[model samples]
Target: MAEGGQIDTDILSDEAFDVLCSMCKNQGKNTEGEQYCVDCKDYFCVSCVKVHSKVPLCAGHKVLDKSQIKSRTSKGLPRAPTERCDRHSHKHIDMYCQKHDTVGCSTCMAVDHRLCKDTFYIPEFIQNNTYQVVATREIQTKLKALDTILAEKADRFKQDKQRLLKRKAEILADIRKFRQEINDHLDKLEKSSINEIEDKVKSLEDKIKDSLKQLQANKSRITSINDKLTSTNTNQSEVFVYVKMAEDAATVAYKYIDDSELQCTTEDIEYQPDITIPTQLEEKKTLGTLAKKHTKTSVSLFQI
Candidate 1:
């Protein structure tokens, strides 16, 4: 209904004044409407009212006839479902059952809740329920606290997520760095081992060269003796040959280097990388729950 729009007449209070017809061309404020469409929750002119009964969805809507409505200036607004029973729409809830903690009409009392207690008045209950009053008042503060606590917890949850991610990245970086260190250590060990083997080979080569040189000198000495004997017509002293024999049994027992001592072997080296994170930390998906608690305010207002 548009503002400043009055009822149709003094006697007959038409419901058409509360809301303006949406289908009408009158966007002006004063629409002295005639009929009320409950489904659309709007007021309509006589002409537009007929369209509501003919339309598909609007046809099923319960409309309050013009005769049932009155103006605010008359008897004020009528008592709505507050006095009426939710279960029995036509009857008012006049009785209360203490045992079942519910309200009902006369028919409901007789048929279902037969053995109920005294008729507990709702107004008295609302006034005297001190626990409900105190709790509701306290819940106002608690409701505000929920928002503040949840905000703080949410910030902490984000911080924890950030920290967890940073720590995870750090652990992974450490693993990579450790791997690089192992590679460098292995490179050093390999270089040292190869240098050792090269030194041993050089020493063996020098010894073999010395042995070959001595053998060559011995051959030269034997050749010189043979020449001298031939020149003397096989008349050279026998002592000379004896002296050659005594020359250190060098030729006969040429002290050979033991090759068996240079057997192949491997160095002692190994790698171990182990880490552990708490199973609880790994399994948990969220930190905790953040929810508004049920309290007297919610239960009273929403009938929870």
Candidate 2:
């Protein structure tokens, strides 16, 4: 036995460093033998290397040292034999036995797979297909998952849009209600002020009418007394009494006349409402800071 089990000297010679040729065994010179692959440990001559390279399945194997092969075999690792099987040790399973689902040497093939017609070489089977079929189902599953994720993201975006729209409508309705309240308050204040101004104007007109009537009566009496004094046969005492009465009426009318009332003063008043709507709200536009100040005055009449 070599290291682990019995050695097959027909495949490897213990004296020579080169592996045996699979075509011509011990009869050929050792220099005529082929180089062996380090990874797969398969022997191939110059011509065999060329033919193996042309074949699709065996093109990727690397060739290395024969001494390295011995070290690997001593360590209980499989070595590429000249005519033995790649899987089984000490048993050269050459021909594939389909009935038993295994490869066999001449003895095994004759014994186990004699009538089995489904057997084939490994190289021929691998060359018939260009790509591996094991990864197809896994790739399809990942693609389906990615599609589902994208669809869910699209639905979420649509739902978010609808929610935003509802929120926007609610905000707009609130703004409108606030604006209406501001307008109603302002209108009430303006109406109250107008009514107060009209009442003051009516009282001032009545006082003005009473003063004008008194002034007209004083003027008429003074004119009549002067005409009597200018007559040819005039009474001095009667004329004097008429003049005294006219003078008293004139003083009374002057006191009753409201001189300060007719002189109205316009005061520039500024009012900032407690509940003020923005200028933008009044204009019914988007809010911005653009305003210009113009002076506005209110006139009020008062008696001295």
TM-score for each candidate, following the candidate numbering: 0.30, 0.22
Off by over 4 Å in 2: 1-130, 184-304
So what's the TM-score on candidate 1? 0.30
For all candidates, the clash counts are 3, 2
What is the lDDT of every predicted structure here? 0.39, 0.38
lDDT of 1 by residue, 156-195 (tens): 3344334333433443344445435432333343343335
Identify the leading candidate in terms of TM-score: 1
Spell out the clash pairs found in candidate 1: 1-18, 1-19, 1-20
lDDT of 2 by residue, 178-225 (tens): 445654544444444334434443443444345445444544444443
lDDT of 2 at 113: 56
